[model samples]
Target: MPDAYSNIHLIVRWLHVIAGITWIGHLYFFNFVNVPLQGSLDDATKKAVNPQLMPRALWWFRWGAMITLLAGLTLFVLTYFYTPGAGFGATSLLMDADGITDRAMWILFGMLLGIIMWFNVWFVIWPIQKKLLTGKVPADQVPAARKKALLASRINTFLSGPMLFGMLAPAHYGTMSFGALLLALGLGVLAIWFSIKSSSRVGKPA
Candidate 1:
């Protein structure tokens, strides 16, 4: 049987995978389906849909993000704290030391992406969505909230590609270069900042 820590880590990883599926799956649905549907829906349908369905979906979406982050952090801690000879800062090779030399860079990228995703869900998506859900913002204001939500969601999607790429890359390709890591880091940060700008509402209606 696995030790207590190992068992805990395994559970966390399982939960992470489950939560990530829910979160990213809904994210894709929102971007690819919901946004387009909004354009096609009549105002009455939109008003009905946004208040009822959208809020519940957003609740699941945000909570899934929270659980994913928690599970990821738990897994990271388990790896860093208990795993023998494992250096959190230095190189990491959990299984295939010979094949997966890029493990460190991949881990770093995944961690960064997780942070950005968590922030987007909690700080950006949830807040604006709450305003729309409550009566704080009128139906007229939903457009602005939606614009903000969509951009943030799309930003999450954009980061998702590279983040998943980096996460799984080590298993396929060798370690990435310092230049490549820096490029990924820069791109991730830019994606996050640009997303914030897209959703900014200082002077906007909602």
Candidate 2:
């Protein structure tokens, strides 16, 4: 059996993978299944379907994201920070003794994306969705709520790719310069901000 240290990170990695798969799977489900169904259904059908099925799915979706974030962050700390002296040459890989600055750049990028997603889920998407589901939000607000949720979800989908690349690259790249690390971080943050900011503009109801 692995020691406690190894066991802990292993568990976190496993949880991260599991939760990430759950989150992305449902994301695809919403994009592929729910959105198309929206067009085919009548207004009454939409009202019923959305208030019931959509919210349930979103609960799983957002929590899966949360769990993934927690587990992934924990793993990052344990593997990169807690371990001493560049185990397996992780420092050499990052061009640092601590190995964290390089990894930090990637984690920072991922955290930025996760922050946007969290805001969307908790602030924009959930609030608006509540209105739509509960009919508490003014009829005027329903459209706005829906638009925000859809747009934010799409934005998350767009950010997923580059964020993953940045997070995984240190492991694969052997070593990265401060300049290259900075460049990756800048590009990741810019991509996230642009995607989310652009999403808000396109969805306002006419």
Q: Report the number of the highest-lDDT candidate.
A: 1
Please list the residue runs of candidate 1 whose C-alpha ends up more than 4 Å from where it truly belongs after superposition: 84-101, 138-142, 170-174, 178-206
**For candidate 2, what is the lDDT?**
0.68
Give lDDT: candidate 2, residue 81: 52
Output the TM-score of candidate 2.
0.73
What TM-score do all the candidates reach, one by one?
0.73, 0.73
| Candidate 2: tens digits of C-alpha lDDT, residues 1-206 | 96777787778889998988888677767765566557668989876667779778979888988898788777766765565534443433233666446555666666677667666666776677667777787877667767777898777766665666666665665345677766665676576556445543444457
Q: Give me the displacement of residue 185 in model 2, in angstroms.
A: 11
lDDT of 1 at 124: 94
Distance from true location, Cα of 83 in model 1, Å = 2.7
Q: How far is each candidate from the true structure, as Cα RMSD in Å?
A: 7.9, 6.5
